[model samples]
Target: MSNPYSEQLSRLMAEYRETQRAMVEAQQRLRSLSVTETAPRRVVSVTVGHGGRVEDIKFPTAAYKRMPPTELASALLDAIAAAQRRAVDEAAEVMAPHMPAGVDARALLSGDVEASSFEVPQSGVSDILRDLMSDPGK
Candidate 1:
């Protein structure tokens, strides 16, 4: 018996190589992706990398001078959040094909609780609202 398991070993090795190739391709695709988001009123724009790092921010000085500080702050927050969300979605897409069947890759990557899964047994609107509005430290 000259390496009786040679065939099986060869097949496994091929599969391992294929998986590595796919991983490299996916990494390249992810690295090339950049999420660009704009603030309200087109006052500011931000480009975020795959890891949610801000790569660039652009806005005309006039635009900044026109908007109030509070509005500008809100716009910055919104744009940054949008960029982060895009990164999460793109990463999910890249990882989805490699994930097992029936597994939600996006949800797994984001670690976000689905709103529809919330259960308030026998709780009325008033009760739920009160609870939500209440102080969390109590």
Candidate 2:
């Protein structure tokens, strides 16, 4: 009889290769999309790209002269968070059309799905690595 284990390993490897290609393409697509969010009163705004990079920030004149420093800071932070959420959503929207059916690109992009869930851990690699490397493993 043929070795079924070999066939299983081959299939697993093929799946892994496909997933890697898909992820790289998704990342590239994300880098191309952009999203922006602004404060409720339009005093602050932030623009972010699909790769979660901040592309720009805008502050209205009134924000600098009328608002206290702490309030201005708070509004900026809120706008950044809003922009990040929009960026993630936009990234998902762009990726949705390209993704395989039933795959949740948003969860993967947002890191809600752990990479470890898909791969095996090698104790040898961890045991021999620096402490800093181990921190990322957790």
Candidate 3:
């Protein structure tokens, strides 16, 4: 005889296993994620990897050599920023499906999401503590 409880348990286990597999795959993809961007003046290019860290930088032209130190630094910063933004967008896309509903993956990847926003109000904590401290038999 086919047991209904066994069937349900089997289905649930299968779902759990699938979820685990998908999450592993997503993490692997995220680990390999990268994005590249170039400065507007084409003086510098930057490649950003996971966590928005710069993996590589390139100067496509000798224009940077003639530019002032501040100008060159600005161009490098701009390219890095652009690459980081694109990397965050890509990471958000990869992570959003794995995250729970209403979670903003883009904001999270960009470091703009606050942990406090997810906190639940403990309005009854004091009351509960007071009740616990009082004599129950009274």
For TM-score, the strongest prediction is: 3
Stretches off by above 4 angstroms in model 1 are 1-4, 113-138
* Reference-based lDDT, residue 104, model 3: 92
What is candidate 1's lDDT per residue for 6-118, written digit by digit as tens?
55457657987999999999889888879998886788888898777889888844587777899888888889889888888998899889765656767876776463554
In angstroms, the error of model 1 at 70 is 1.4
Candidate 3 residue lDDT tens string, 1-138: 875445655776797799999999988988999899988777998999988989999998888889999999998998898888888899899999977667899997777888567655454445544554584442
Best candidate (score: lDDT): 3
TM-score of each candidate structure, all chains considered together: 0.73, 0.59, 0.79
lDDT (Cα, tens digit) per residue for candidate 2, span 36-70: 88887888878888667888998755655688889
Question: How high a TM-score does candidate 2 get?
Answer: 0.59
Clashing pairs in 2: none
Query: Sort by lDDT, best first: what order?
Result: 3, 1, 2
RMSD of 2: 10.9
State each model's CA lDDT, in order.
Answer: 0.76, 0.73, 0.82
